[model samples]
Target: MMFEGFLFVIHLFLHTYCQLQVVAQCFINLLRWWRVNKWNADIFLNQTKNLGKIPGHVSLMFLEEDTPVEDIVKPIVWCICLGVTTISLYDYYGRLRSKKLDIDKELREYYSDFTKNCRNSPKNQPSPRIQFVSVENGRTDLVYAARDIAQDLLNGVVKEVTKVNYQNYHKVFRNDHPDLMMKFGIHTTLAGYPPWPVHLTEIISLPTCHMISPYNFLDCLNRYFKIEKRVGK
Candidate 1:
């Protein structure tokens, strides 16, 4: 009976050790796969740049309010320097009372400074246009405005609909659409960004927006290039 009990203890220990070994091996393999995927993504990005088809418009989404405006603006500057045309910045938490107004004021000030500095710089080109929209509040306003206009047209209060096209509707919403949306958060959720512009927009979620760098921006562009956009086919 003593010998049997000792054998049972040894068997349990061996089983536990094997299970731990399996888990460790899985973790190592996952790490290896991640490294390889990153390497491949880098190579693909370089090749795409060589092909000269960078994303035209990029949107960034984040929740934090205290994140320095410079952290957001610097990335936009870098994207513009890289020849991206339109940049959209969305603050999810800006929907709170007075937050959106504060954000807008700060952005306007930053943009004014940025443009002033760019004009003074010798290497200045046409800077990309930056637009800030609070996801929840802005979208609601846009939808309401559109509904009012449509209602007016139906009631014949506004005569003569000159154009009946998608572009006309786009104009109504001010044409603030994005080609790729980069989300800076732990979760992959969109956090209530406007649904109208993202019909085909590629969303890339990053771990966090605390310490964004130029390389991180480049990686986003790389990921954007990997997406094959099939527009409503």
Candidate 2:
């Protein structure tokens, strides 16, 4: 009975310590966000550039299905301003994917406002290419790829399963693999993001964000560069 009581006390202490750590980290993150928010988009990009290499393709995953379309646009615009060419937005379910058009329109408006206020010349900015991905996209692509592979095997196009290469799957899902994936919530579960594409991607998670604050977005990108991706090494 005494041993079990001691174990319970230890667990309580550990849990309390963890909660305090979380609170301290949250406070630090808030301060960083405040500082980053003061800078213009161009300035933030310039400062972050010195951190390391910028990602050409970025994936933003919102754990919540009901995340507002406007909130989704903020990060997309931030990616554009940071000179990221390809941006993918994802949610667990297909809810956000269904509103792709609305998000696209909002992105245009949001980016337009950003550009107008931006100190950088319009010609210097690169237009962002946005893709909305959901679990359904992955499911469909997997099904298509499997069917193709099966047909190839039956028709002697592919002799063995071991002979199938990345190219076979790439042909079915033509989207560029993301260089960096950022999750906008504390939840660690990927919530059904396509696994194949992100095998080598650097993923960073931030606290739950209802709106894409400038600091959190920029910090996430900065963190991406600092990570050493030693995949399968």
Candidate 3:
């Protein structure tokens, strides 16, 4: 009985000792982290490199800290004043040179003051609306495509062109009027095909083996008649 009692006391002391050692290690690790994090705050605040200059054109919202109101206001003011000032200056000069309005020193000064007022006025910046036109919606491109479709038809004006020259027509057409080209359908492969266009496959393959190249030669398409003229004349 005495030996058993003695073993129990020794086991209790070893368990308590192990638990205390674990707690002490935990406190040491906690203390190290606390010091590291505290020092990191100071290191970040003093790091004055890329933080000062923002990337790209100014976006309203991305920043590490609350941005100074002045930073946002200044560029907006510059852009607004510069835009109005340029228009006003152009008008003022144009009127003077064209003799449309009698230009006096007072009028020039008044124009400058008006531009200044427009910049300093702070009514929340309005969003600029942008409108876009696509190649499929352009005027000149549509008209050019229409003209080309009829060019080989009826008139017999220019040499009948092969489908391979589609892009060639498009390039020249766009160069003359690019703004309208973007509004019309620039590319359409099967759009203008006639009901009998598939039969042109036979003419293209010669022996009607398969696949057509260069141009579809449907017998029904009047354009095919030009093949003889094109080869000879």
* Regions of candidate 1 where Cα sits further than 4 Å from its true position: 1-51, 95-124, 136-139, 154-157, 160-173
- The number of the candidate with the highest lDDT is 2
Which one wins on TM-score?
2
Task: Give lDDT tens digits, candidate 2, residues 1-233.
Answer: 99999999999999999999999989977865664356566675666767666788888888864666767778777777767888888887767778878987997776665566666734466576777787876767788778887888899987776533634564323557788888887787888787888888888987765655776786776677677786656
Predictions: Cα RMSD each:
10.8, 9.9, 28.4
Clashes of each: 0, 0, 10
| lDDT (Cα atoms) of all candidates against the true structure | 0.63, 0.74, 0.31
Kindly report which residue stretches of model 3 are placed more than 4 angstroms away from their true locations once superposed.
41-233
Compared with the true structure, what per-residue lDDT tens digits does model 1 show for residues 123-164? 345767666656554567667667767887899877755434
Residue 92 in candidate 2 has what lDDT? 72
Span of 10 residues, lowest total lDDT, candidate 2: 163-172
Whole-model lDDT, model 2: 0.74
Pairs with backbone N, CA or C atoms under 3 Å apart (clashes), candidate 3: 134-182, 135-182, 135-184, 136-183, 136-184, 137-183, 137-184, 138-183, 138-184, 200-218
- lDDT by residue (tens digit), candidate 3, 100-208: 1332343334334333434333234353211112222234555776687677566775456565554455422221111100001123222222212122221211222
What TM-score does candidate 3 get on C-alpha atoms? 0.19
Pairs of residues clashing in candidate 1: none
